[model samples]
Target chain A: MINEERTKMMTRLALYETKEGKKELKITRYSPGDYVMLQMLWSFVCGTLAFVIICVLAALYNIETLMTELFSMDILLFARNILVIYIIFIACYLMFCYSYYSYRYGKYKKRVNAYILRLKELYKHYVQNGNNQNM
Target chain B: MATLLMMKEKMKEIYAEYYKVIVPTVKAVVAFLMLLAINDKIGYMARLDSFLVVLVLTAVCAFTPTGITVLVGLAVILGHLSALSFEIALVALAVFMVMGLLYLRFCNKDLILLVLVPLSFYFGVPYVMPLVAGILCGPVAALTLGCGIVIHYFIDYISVNALTIQGMAAEGTVDKIRVGVDGLIRNEAMFLTLISFVAATLVVHILRRQSMDHAWSIAIFSGAMCNVILNFMGLLVFDNGPSVFGLLIGTIIAIPLAMLVGLLFMGLDYSRTEKVQFEDEDYYYYVKAVPKMNIQAPSKTVKRINTQRYHTNQK
Candidate 1:
């Protein structure tokens, strides 16, 4: 009867093991620097959208006849300019992304690695306790 | 009155946190220098008769915590916006006195080195820019200088010419340079505003992710509302129909862009699964902590169990 009860308790604890592992993994995956990158990207997108919308409106209103004229003069040039501008933006964004990821990875490795180490120690303690009792 | 008192207490907490990160002396110095430059620029541009009012407002901001200072500063700024003529010299003197008081009261050797040494450029550049290029060039120079700093991300340089404006220069000397996306989109003020919005949104997202309450949502909403109000104020000041329409269009475009970028950058999956999980976490924590006695009873538990089983299977 005691053995049966012990088996039930062990099963219950086992059920939570997967969940606890999942939680720790999730925590490790996200960091403050990730949030910062998200903020930067969101701002860039918003600012770009704002610029594009304003440009479209200005085009519609014929606010800058000169720009329209220039566009008409060389469609290829306009497209090229747009492409170059977007490439520059992408490069800047990539630089920010690299920095953000490195920063977050450093934090994760420092703090969360220590946490995982502590968790492993606890797991070892549990295993040792269980083995001793069994013996 | 009670609410106001509560708010003041809350603000004190916020100030304490802010002070931990950014020194009060640095904030005061930055406020003083920025305000002084702004005042000088405005005075040079249109013979702003209320220069003293601006100086006084700047002084108030430097000495006090941010909240009341922002309010007083806004009032004076609004007055200046209305083209009211006020005593410039007296306001300047008052502001100087306030700066002096802040220095005497809060200044320490370490504090001075931390605050003043770095901001020497922030203070000195604005003052020197106008002297070298004349008064009308100040704001343009300031804006350009700020943009250049942001662009380099580490280095500070002065590159913007103030005499580029037509009214500031001799006839036929005003070069009508082609305004490209680079020029239009690179305005420091607008960039800073967008950055601030992003920061607020990030804070909100992180708070929500941590299964915190909707307080951050309210904060972000309030910030966006401020931007909307400022946009309206911009419309009032500029009074250009197309520009106003463009701003509205810009806002409309921002929504989807924000979502797209959030998904791309933060991996915020806005699907039903994530939403349900988040809601479940929030509800579970709240109910576990805040009791409703036997009124809700076992039905709540049963419902939660059912939902949990469903989620478990789905996962």
Candidate 2:
């Protein structure tokens, strides 16, 4: 009886080991809040990059001279002003991104901590069951 | 009373999960209006009018919940009206605003790239390209004229007007020819806008699904296809004669075209590879372990044995 119980516990432990190996296959759904923050950060980066690239090309090609005839402002000044405005906009956006992510990460950590506690309880239960069988 | 309480609890859980989705959707609507206001295309009054429209629509959709079936219908009508008012800026703003708000509300930042990618295309293709052409044309024309004058002094060809070449006219035709041209321009703009909207939506939908691990491509494709169908229906009702056959054919063509555009323009499948791991120390075990067990366990067996059994025992 003792040997059978020992063998059973060993088998169960082995099963758990195999399960652990396959844990990555588990589908973890994101909380919608986290997903949105990440999306915003991505758009911010892409938008800024695009704005920067366009500004650079406009400067390099001296596209402003083409516009000076049509518009009141000098091409170089207009480009400079637009570039400055975009830079400020991008800086503000980055600030928003940092604050938002930090708050979300904090919330996520709390949820994860609770999850860990539940798992620890399950682990305790499995251990107790194994010990009872041994007795 | 007990059942009611349980139902309330269940509703709360659903709300918790859906809150992210709802917040962003509402925010997007608000932001789009704000953008319009900033752009001066829509006055405060118009923004207020649209805000009320969106609010009413939201309330109706929320109450019916099943009204999602009609979302595309509403979007089409509003989108069309907005476009007619030359409020494309407002519409674009609304799209991004809604997308941004939703991203913030839902915690889906990665999907923003989906919005940005298409936005870049929209701005790049329509506005930037035209501006570039306009800018470059003068210099090129000047160079050509200068060279011609230097080489062949007798050869004379005055450059075509930039505004005309750029397709901008101060005064349009007022007679039958005017009507025909107006009709053609309207049709062209509508078609282009439809294509652009569909393309953007498709790109976003594909990215969203791939990001969310959703298996509802059919639903999304159908929804997008429905836009063209709805546009045709609007045309029949409001504008020209009813062409049911044309509507069907347009939908058939539009669906594939939108999909093709989406596939070509849609960026990386980053969502597939990017894993969002919760780093909380306390919940780490639950997040990492319980979900594994819950998933690995025969799903049906766990649902039947654990949740149902627990409910029954409690009862």
Candidate 3:
């Protein structure tokens, strides 16, 4: 006789393991701070690269005018302005990453905790059936 | 109504029975249409303009991940733009890079919105994107749709100015790039559409989340109204937005399509709603459960009786 409850529990566990459980298992291995920091670093790199692409495109668009104004241009002021914009842009992007990854970590933690609870319940059922298993 | 529901059930049954084949077929059809639209809009490259090439690419897109289709679409667009001018292609690449790095990374699942929005605009039913996005997605969809609007305008600009850009070939590379970048930046119509669509998406998203009867229907209608009103207002003020008549016609056509999306995705039978209160160790939950509008296909029984054999046995 198959135990309907055990079968249902096993099915649920198997489904989770295949779906979100794959990511959640990996996520739970890291501390929340570490995960958020890692994501923020990624965001910073992408933001800087995108900013450079935009700046290059803008320079190319104004190539003729830039060539003429090259001698008279206040190079320091222009550099400073670009730097300020980059700083502000990357700061905003990093903050967004921080919030998003933090929220994800919290959610994944809750799911992992629930999965552990289900595993414990399954173990208790086995123990009641004279299976001396230690998790 | 019952007959329609029965048909829907039967169709759903058929879909479930042949899901694997149906999915790839639908994907192929969609990819084929999108590629054809691209070629029609900006087929500067002679090689990619052939029907056989599109069919081959569509076959490839059908079996791969959906993101592959998006990548292939981008490649086709770039190929056409490069034929016109390398600078224009570079400008497009930069814009796509910015959109991808900043906005798209956060919500990759909504990438299909990028393709659908431009395609809808080509079909003159652009208003459906925001309405459908509002019903099905969250606020992030507004940003994705905005990116789509930008792409449509970029393609439109290139198509409209292909001759002008080609005529300026002897002027210098700087002039061509400047014209391409400036056109995209100075496009008031694109900005207007972007703002209106984003607003409509947010309105629909908010309204559909309300716990009321016919909320999705109300949300879709209100979203359509918001889109129409905003576009009309922008047109009256800016005088450079989409034509008033086209805007009106598109919104009128979009309302029913949006309703169909809502019904298919979120149709609920509210008459059988159940409200229950339960308490657990940490919290008390007040839940309202509304069943989905589903009609199972009725089963048929065919019983065969051999009367001649029965008569022989009796004899």
Error of 2 at A68 (Å): 6.3
Of the candidates shown, which would achieve the greatest TM-score relative to the real structure? 3
Off by over 4 Å in 2: A1-43, A46-72, A131-135, B1-74, B77-79, B82-315
Q: Which stretches of candidate 1 lie over 4 Å from their true place?
A: A1-77, A115-135, B1-26, B44-119, B122-315
Q: What are the per-model DockQ values?
A: 0.01, 0.02, 0.32
* Per-prediction tally of clashes: 3, 34, 0
TM-score of the B chain in each candidate versus the native B chain:
0.24, 0.23, 0.84
Top model number, lDDT = 3
Query: Candidate 3 residues B161-236, lDDT tens each?
Result: 9999888856578888887898678888998999999999999999999999989889999998999899888887
Model 2: per-residue Cα lDDT at residue A73:
60
lDDT, candidate 2, residue A86? Answer: 89
Span of 10 residues, lowest total lDDT, candidate 2 chain A: A20-29
Best first by DockQ, ranked: 3, 2, 1
DockQ (model 2, Cα): 0.02
TM-score between model 3 and native = 0.86
Q: Relative to the true structure, how large is the alpha-carbon lDDT of every model?
A: 0.38, 0.38, 0.83
lDDT of 2 by residue, A1-135 (tens): 233443433333334434432332221244546555665678576656655544443342443464566476677986698868887877776676666655655565565555556566546655665545434
Q: Could you give the CAPRI-style class of model 3?
A: acceptable
